[model samples]
Target: MKLAGLTIAYWCVLVMALVPMGCAWLAKAGQLGKPRRQGGFDNHNPRAWLARQTDWRARANAAQDNTFEALPFFIGAVVIAHQLGAVQMRVDVLAFLFVVLRLLYVMMYVADLATARSAVWALALLVNIAILFV
Candidate 1:
């Protein structure tokens, strides 16, 4: 089925906007906080301990930047596709993959799996490239 440029743009916007929301959810849920430690640890609370274990705030900030990082490419892809007179099905398919893969990337990042997340990120990058060339 054919998809509209406006529709794809809206979907991209929605996906990008959700990244920070997920991060905020994690922080609010205490998932981003410190982890529990055995005796002899300096920090008492798990949150504080986890904070010392890793710079989660920095990670979250990076995720935010990643989301923003996607914006230009996403917008450029749509604009290029529209200008190049690409088929709606082709554009839609790329758009769908880009959005889904990005969401998965964000989730994997939050979970701290670098290898798999990088693969997903690469896939999304390829999709963007495809859109630009198509």
Candidate 2:
């Protein structure tokens, strides 16, 4: 189904594109806004500071990295679904499922639930594959 003649699947594509921005923001959040002189939130040496993150902040950073890693496949799957003229409803559902699974994955990562997070990550990968095939 389309609103304003735009397939629902494309909306998911838009969300997928915007997701990287959220990941980038979350990466910055891990820095906690300390001055560069104090060894935190350094512009010139950001990765080094982020490398020192611990607890949930550290997990959040990892989640951001994982999120970025997932994006290319997810976006490609959605685009391929559209190109193949897959059923819009199925494509949209799978795309939406991928997004939900990713959100859960991120939360599980931050909570340090390794088993659950990995499970959710696997599920999201499956969802992306389904979108591509369907």
Q: Estimate each model's TM-score.
A: 0.68, 0.86
Give all candidates' CA lDDT scores.
0.69, 0.80
Model 2 agreement with the true structure over 30-133: per-residue lDDT tens digits: 35577777655777876787788688767887888888888889888888888987888999888888888888888888788999999999888888889889
Instruction: State residue 108's C-alpha deviation in candidate 1, in Å.
Output: 0.9
Which pairs clash inside model 1?
A: 34-47, 34-50, 35-50
Worst 10 residues of 2 by lDDT: 23-32
For candidate 1, the 10 contiguous residues with the lowest summed lDDT are 34-43
Off by over 4 Å in 1: 1-5, 28-58
Tens digit of per-residue lDDT, candidate 1, span 48-98: 533443455445545656877887887788778878888867887787888
